[model samples]
Target chain A: MFSITGLLTISGILFVAGAAALITRRNAVAALMGVELMLNAANLNFVAGWRYFWPERLDAHVAVLLVITVAAAEAAVGLAIILNLYRKFGTVDLEQIRLMRG
Target chain B: MTHAQLTALLPVILLAGTAVALLLVQAITRSHRVTAGVTLAGLAAALVAVTRALPQGATPVTALLTIDRFALLYTGLLALIGIGLTLLSFLYLAGRTRLTGAYYILFTLALAGGAVLASSAHFAAFFLGLEMISVSLFALAAYRRDDPAGIEAGMKYLVLAGVATAVLLFGAALLYARYGTMAFAALGTAIAPGAGDPLTLAGIALVVAGIGFKLTLAPFHLWAPDVYEGAPAPVTGFIATISKAAVFALLLRLFTQVHLREHPALFAIFATLAIASIFAGNLLGLRQMNLKRVLAYSSVANMGYLLIAFLAGGPAGAIAATFYLTAYLPALLGIFTLLTALSGRERDADAIADYAGLAWRRPVLAAAFTVLLLSLAGIPLTGGFIGKFYVALTGVSAALAGSPAFWALVGALVVGSVIGLYYYLRIVLAFFQRTPAGEEPAAITRRVPDAAAIVLTLSTLAVLWLGVLPGNTLTLISLLVEEWFR
Candidate 1:
């Protein structure tokens, strides 16, 4: 059966998994992918909430669209920054990029 | 939107238009002087627009934005600060980078975003404005692409800010699912005092954490020192001031609307964050040799102090927070401007030892630096002292009104300020120390730019004015807060 609880549970799992990936992954690109996962998980929750609770309102749809647009912009900027880092340091590993530490 | 609503949004419209104009100017002619000139004029026009619209009172432009006196006040302040930063950037970027036009474009866009944040009344607007600022910063932080440290700062900010945005969005989604409304006023009505489901409470917690990261409160503040130490000095100032002030303004508005003080558990959460940030920021700053890192940690503690006033809750608290932020701007900006002036072609002059024996070499510049540092340390006869005084007064009043938690917050404030004094004095002491025979006096030889000198002088005067004659400013802030609450 299609259920709000079921969808929410899946999103929760996705969020945690994304956070885990972000924390454990040393590669910058993979970490960005993790951020994308987390963003999608939020989008999923918005969709489920709209379907189950407030079908009369389109707030959820607008919010999801906005979130998606922001995510796209974020990805573009994130990748560009990572590319610049690669050109200078020749590595995308977060551990290796530690020139400014105490 | 009605005519009144359109008129009320004049400042924001002008800011966005200026950004687009900057791009067209860049496309036609790649002259740095012209681009910088256009940016200054645009920001000046926005400031004028804000002043003109201040009389319009509160006008809800749409479901997303509400232009009230409080919003106009902050918008005006942000534009004024924007002008100062643009001038500083013009000086900082000259001969340092060829791609100067894009920096102005991003800078104006970030200003527009801050304006949006100040006036936003809905979740959509909040998220959009925040992303605007965050994305622009990602580029601005990495503007010096050849510099490895700049790239690292940009990457760290991008990833961490992305995660924060996601967490905040999920929290918003959860609230929407529970309440079926996203408007701040409506959400306030939906959320009863001290009464919320697990999902709703969790949503609030996540949102707080997200903002905490942006504001660089404790535990979420690990990225700040690195980013501050790595990014260009002027950009760090922007991060510390404009970006932080806008977010804090939004936080105050949101919490005020939601009556967060009525929720004991949430109130306690804020208190804990405040205390932790105060101690953590002060304690961590003690060992830092880098001036940028020291300032970064100082900012963390300053935010904590601001929260003390914020948690005091009511019109007085709001007034105190706003006034504190206003006082903070000049000192912070002055220090960064001085840093930019002293920086060499290769890297920023960010070491504590760089200022050794500065007083003997440049007495005027050293005096200005001393005043600025005294302000940051909350010493008497500076704006920072008055700001801190208001915060403590509000905390005491809140405690008298029945919330004993504020006493602890006030205690933390006192302890933090005392600890903060040590590092600030260390820098001051460096300024007067005699130069060793072998060390070079290169920093002293660098000619201070006229524009930078004017900014520093004005900052020192403003700090003294706020400290000596705070009554007028206090009255102005209280009047705005009264109007807002009405």
Candidate 2:
């Protein structure tokens, strides 16, 4: 079996990179891709924790399944919103759509 | 999974069934009114079920979910808010949209998710409930897909809220890594005072950050004003009242169940967040001309006030927070209902100028708005006043019990409330201003539906009743808190 600490280290990097991309990316779709990465990282952590720590308890493994389902759902909604935004503003760049602001 | 579990989950089952029934009804008839009626009936039935189950008191439905007096009370409150939102959505969508049936389905789904959130006993349930709420809210925020602002708001909420959930899940994984369990009841035994493990501390901090984003406490509050401004008025009201209140309920449960108060560092972290949110919310609100943005900032400040009660970390703090939420809800619901009544077919009447001279044309609406605004500003004879009073009292008692930070937090609360009064009164003042020259009188010809009117009137009366005589509610909340902790 592979080392759990190595898996955790890689997962942590993915989480940080995804968070950075989410914050810095201007394209709505790209930002959403970042969100997906972060979610996957969390799922990896859950699976890793379940395998190395609580092998008998299936809750964390079940949590991975739930996270995947939720991520898919969230991504669908995010893409739909982005399409709507593009239809209205002719672009998915978040900075340009500034209709409602203080 | 068993008879007892089935009974305990009846309210959630009722809500889920209603959502599915709504979808089936939409497939056949597609009548918005009928769909809304069915949804309201479902919520009412669930509320009745919760009330009936209240005497059962703190029944663990499964490892994931618990039904306690606290959960039952919040479930009841959530149902009432659901009914109010359904009525407001009915009015907001009538004759303007054909897909209103879908809105009710999503509404019921969101409410059911919130109920689960209030009763969640494990991290798995917590994440599922939270995701259900966020997913539905993403759709609701952009319901008016034609509106660029709404779509943008939805996109932003989707991205940011997704990130926050990831952080929260990672934190849960960390805790599971260290303790080998994700259940709160078991967590207390796993974590001891002054253990000071770095991994555990990091996990807790990430979890707090995740929750803070949802609550829109300052620094994490940048998306709130824009999202609030961009969303439909009724949905904004839902975010302000139902979602925030339920999340606060969950946070309280988690904090107490895990004995987070035993960690002095965590207390310091919460104190810093409370102070920053109060100052930032008040300071940001002072300059906003848009009504929704102003309310958004004020909500942040109010959350700060709630944190003070949360920091007290005992029966007194729990009672104060519950009482404050009890008072805050009706006023928020009343104001947003009035906004829905004033909205035109194309856009909401959100500009301050739209409210100017409102008293001259819609006197009753104006008066109701005045009571709601005054209540929000924490003026005497309003629910906000009593809510603020109890929060301050809780802080003072905490100081007496030897936490100096509570004293400072109370000082900030007072200062923040005074700043808050200026903006709330500005809207109240706009209502009395004369209509500008060469402009038609500020008479909105839109018909206020009977349901909307009833909601406004009831909420107005509740604000006044709770403000003037809060003793009964306070006693009841204290009794529940005592029972909950025991």
Candidate 3:
């Protein structure tokens, strides 16, 4: 049997690693990848919670599905914006776009 | 869904269906005017739906949504704002681009999302509504695709908001795991007072962080000024008024449902956020030369003010919070409308110099700007004054045997308003100043669109009317809160 502790530990690691990449990366797409990783980690947590505690309710399962769909839509928007950024500035590095500094 | 549920969801259906039809129509007719007309009609229809439903009283629409007085009030207000925005967009952005149709479409979608968001009582509905609004905003913020600043703002908002949502979802998952339900009422019953469960506490903290990011509370508000400055003026108005208002309304409902005031630790967190936002918002805004950035910081401070009443944690606090929001919306929208009108062909009229000699050039606009800014600064004879007075009164009333935290919040509110006044008057002073020698008067003074002017006039009346006599609206809000909390 897959222990809840193991799944929880894995999600915890996934979350921290994703957050680290999100903060440390300079590329917008890479940062978005970090976001996706974090979302997936949350999805794993949702499934674990569903399996261990609330198997009778479909809420967590449905929530995980919705999260996946939303993440895809979010990625689509993120990539499109990044594409627009590259078209405007000829680079996708977050540090390079400095037009709005106070 | 039952027929009753369908009837209850009529407003959302009207908005969503009209948006899709409008998008399809754009393929055939390339007229921005036609698109704008459809958008306004859609919003008006949705408003009618809300009115029809209001008399029926609170009705649960499906498991996710609730059609209640609170939701009806917020939805109606946002729809009015939506119609005003459509008018402003048509007047301000027409002929600037051939592809202006998407702006209306996205605007409608965002409005629908806000309506759904304001009505949601379950986590599923909440998350879905939030993502819908956020995704559309990502596109709308960058709608002027040719502008680099627009794209940068879009990217920043997308990334940060995504992180915040992930945190919020994780918190929800933890809570669901512990409590066995995702409904707010169910969670309220599941958790006992002073339970002190570590997992529940952690989950609540994470959820607060996520909501704080959306509210742009201090220490998590760095992205707000930049995004506000970069976004098109109309979109900035939507973000400032409708989007933030819906989220705050939802937070009020969610927090009160859980009886969050029973926990002192959470109270400390709210106090810290409120204090920091007020101080940081005022102090940082003092140095801003760009008018949009100044308003952005002022909005941060205003959110802090809203939190003070919210922290009072009683019927009085709820009434004050709704009243303050109702008062603040028109003032914010009026300023943005004027900014939209004054923006020239090349750039937005956001700099302090943009308003120099404005009173001499455009007397009515300058007058409107003066009234709005005065309201923002909480000057007497303005709606903001009444809002602030009520907030402080709620706090002081709490001070009678309540914790010292309440008194401290009121002190910060007073000090913050004083600091805020200096910056607001600086703008007012610029408006009436004489035109400098050899300075060219911008042509924006001559070509104020009829629609924009109408919006300005309406909002001006709302500001003055609410400021002078707030009794009717205050009583309505009090009654609404009474029924709403039940």
Ranking by DockQ: 1, 3, 2
lDDT of 2 at B39: 91
> What lDDT, from 0 to 1, does candidate 3 have?
0.86
Q: How far off is residue B237 in model 2, in Å? A: 1.2
Evaluate model 1: give its lDDT. 0.91
TM-scores of the candidates are: 0.99, 0.97, 0.97
Q: On a 0 to 100 scale, what is the lDDT of residue B10 in model 3?
A: 90
Kindly report which residue stretches of model 1 are placed more than 4 angstroms away from their true locations once superposed: none
Residue-by-residue lDDT tens digits, candidate 1, A1-102: 779999999999999989999999999999999999999998988998899999999999999999999899999999999999999999999999899886
Give a tens-digit lDDT track for model 3, residues B212-315.
88888998889899989988888888889988998888888788877777877788899999999999999999989999999989999999999999999678
Tens digit per residue, CA lDDT, model 2, B1-486: 776666668888898899999989988898777888899899999988887777676788878999888887888888988889889998988867787887888888888889999999999988988887888888999998777777877877887688779889888888888788889889878898856887688788888988998899987898999889988999888888888988899999899887756898888888989999999999999999888999999999999999999999889889989999999999999989988888887888777777888777678888889999999889989898999999999999999988887889999999999999999989888888877555633334456788889999999999999999988888888877788667
The count of backbone overlaps in candidate 2 is: 0
Give the candidates in order of lDDT, highest first. 1, 2, 3
Each model's DockQ score: 0.87, 0.74, 0.80
For all the candidates, what are their Cα RMSDs to the real structure? 1.0, 1.5, 1.4
lDDT (Cα, 0-100) at B470 in candidate 1? 93
The collision pairs in model 2 are none
Query: Which parts of model 3 are misplaced by more than 4 Å?
Result: B441-446
